[model samples]
Target: GEEVAQTPKHLVRGEGQKAKLYCAPIKGHSYVFWYQQVLKNEFKFLISFQNENVFDETGMPKERFSAKCLPNSPCSLEIQATKLEDSAVYFCASSQSGNTEAFFGQGTRLTVV
Candidate 1:
């Protein structure tokens, strides 16, 4: 079972502060993706990367959100200058891209003041 795991299932940060989240992908995985779910309803893809390079980041916020996929260190999402609108559940997922389904983490629910 290759499932992603995220920490701090919930997070709270005041405006202008920083928010950091962690994600542990299934062992032996090489591709990781990050997404933001607003209102716990809809999902918005933020970024995707294979290995340590940026694959795509079409839906990411231009002001403050960044992600990385490192070797066995677990992917991470860092958001600077938090805002009320930034409150949402951040999901991390990984897949082998062959016969495996994309596995998602429980997500980190971030709340901003």
Candidate 2:
């Protein structure tokens, strides 16, 4: 079975500052995904990557959010110019395909003021 790992269970930042979250998908996984859970319920897809290439990022928040999948570096999500509404739990996941269930990491909670 595959799993995902993330660190810094919480983050706090002032407005206009930057926030970064980290994730490591289980070994052998080929696809990685980043999601934002603002409501603490439904997961909002942010971006996904296969190998080193981005598969899709249609759900990303324009201008403030960005993600990357670095070679041997796992994955990361960054938020620049944080806002009060940016408080949420960020989750990383890995899956073989969209049809399959994804393995989620222990989420990183971010709070901005």
The most accurate candidate by lDDT is 2
Alpha-carbon shift of residue 95 in model 1 (angstroms): 0.5
lDDT of 1 by residue, 38-109 (tens): 985898988888777888889888689888877758788999999999999998998876246778999999
lDDT of 2 by residue, 42-98 (tens): 789899999778999999987999888889896889999999988999999988765
Best by TM-score: 2
TM-score of each: 0.91, 0.92
Q: What ranges in model 1 sit over 4 Å off?
A: 98-100
Give stretches of model 2 more than 4 Å off. none
Clashes per candidate, residues 3 or more apart or on different chains = 0, 0
How well does model 1 score by local distance difference test? 0.86
lDDT of 1 at 31: 75
